[model samples]
Target chain A: MSQGEPGIELDTSLGYMLKAAASALHSAMEAVLSPLGMTITHYSCLELLAQRPGLSNSELARGAFVTRQSMNVLLQSLERQGLVIRPARAPVGRALPTELTDLGRRQLEVASAAVRRVEQNMLADLDTDEQDQMRRLLRTCITSITEPPASTT
Target chain B: MSQGEPGIELDTSLGYMLKAAASALHSAMEAVLSPLGMTITHYSCLELLAQRPGLSNSELARGAFVTRQSMNVLLQSLERQGLVIRPARAPVGRALPTELTDLGRRQLEVASAAVRRVEQNMLADLDTDEQDQMRRLLRTCITSITEPPASTT
Candidate 1:
């Protein structure tokens, strides 16, 4: 019945499946994170800061897949909560580099382990080779969409 | 320097790559759909209705991977815009069965095609076998996470 239209076949569409997988992972992460009073974006910000310290607000937003304004709001909340801190003035440029407080790292240590367990559970059924294959396919798809159109490139 | 923690390695983590792929596809879809005045969730709701004419608000919420409250808000807006219709009273159960208007179908035709293009672009580099592999891999991951943990199952 749907053959006449160009609508995506939800059962077979790679995009839909990708979304479902991502959404499942997100919900699982949230399940683990929420008990500790963290949202995915909030946990993401702290994790990013842990791995790459002194990242600016804009960079953190990009890394967290959020807008700069939303990241700024989160930063302010985190600051008030003493989870993160930014200097009163930019030492080098207009961007204020953000850092995690001692409390932040302690919180992140717990949250990170929970998140890792969720990821591990998600991959529990798959073997190493299959995990690698999934990773490759996902990376290929990301490159296809993120890179410039073929005509321009 | 960072060997002590369980924090996910952003570069090698399958879950992180899954998120990146989904986010890229989401951005690509938004780029196309926004020009036609649609958000992904907005488009998802219409598309779900087109494919399943009698889906209830809760069912639509499940299909679209959004909370019931968010789906309720979207439905109200869609109803006000004359894109969808529900009976003044429930026809059968407490759930209100929703169906799209002719206008909604017409709008969906255009947005569906645009979304299809975005999906195609994302899969441009993959062969049929690779696409099938990705579908299998994604389905497996979804199942692993969504099914009861092995102890309970």
Candidate 2:
């Protein structure tokens, strides 16, 4: 209960700041993406596909940080909208590789520009070196959490 | 569509890395919080109350980065469980200032300990200086995203 002990000071905690940054980024992305008839996850899916075509549903889900089941539903809707296509069967394993249609690509082009602007704007204050440092620090945090806990005797 | 131009490199994008770090932190917190019979947002609500005891529902919503509607639902549930209380009617304006009960404070003690461990584990690799740098950089990113976009010609 003491302020200096286990009590988390929301102002100075790196974890809280990280979440706040992410939340701000998420909100900014959504504000732009929503006007384009897409959610942040939806834009993420298209961006993933644009960068790496012929990705499976599960891979896309992982790339977009969403559940496969939810991505499956989204993919189905995209398929019906003629924005993407999947063969009737998986030509390889049980994983169907997905590709964006020409229309999807066109739509993504516009969305990508808007998103790029958002990201670039967010880094407006930080210089190139600072941006790199931020990335490294963030990656370290990710590793620390994902790795096993230190010995707790 | 060309690499090095408009195409975002997923492997190195700062935004993507930020999301990854947040996701990792979220999973770690959930792992610890779940066993304690709580979710991340639930723990966040209690923690916010512990630190600032009279946060209103809308204020908590903003602090926790959830919608007011969702936070209201959660608040009602917490009140029912006798973890928090709000006056029968708003003593000041329509906003009811919320306070944690003694039981709420007790539950938060356990949850806070668990969360602190997760946070400490996540910062194990970073030195003291780097942690401060991270906080500054993250606050910058948050500010960048929240501020209005620079004028584009």
**Mind sharing the TM-score for model 2?**
0.93
Could you tell me the interface RMSD of model 1? 3.7
State the lDDT of candidate 2 residue by residue for B68-129, as single tens digits. 99999999999999999998888767888899999999999999988898899999989999
User: What's the chain B TM-score of candidate 2?
Assistant: 0.94
| Pairs of colliding residues, candidate 2 | none
Worst 10 residues of 1 chain A by lDDT: A1-10
Stretches of candidate 2 exceeding 4 Å from the true structure: A1-8, A150-153, B1-5
Per-residue lDDT, model 2, residue A134, is 89
Cα-based lDDT at residue B91, candidate 2: 79
Q: What's the i-RMS for candidate 2 in angstroms?
A: 4.3
Query: Which ten contiguous residues of candidate 2 chain B have the minimum total lDDT?
Result: B1-10
Q: Please report the candidate that would top DockQ against the real structure.
A: 1
lDDT score for residue A30 of model 2: 88
Q: Taking the tens digit of each residue's C-alpha lDDT, what string does model 1 give over A1-153?
A: 343345888889898899999999999898889999999999999999999788899988887899999999999999999999999998876888899999999999999999888898999989999998888888888898998756521
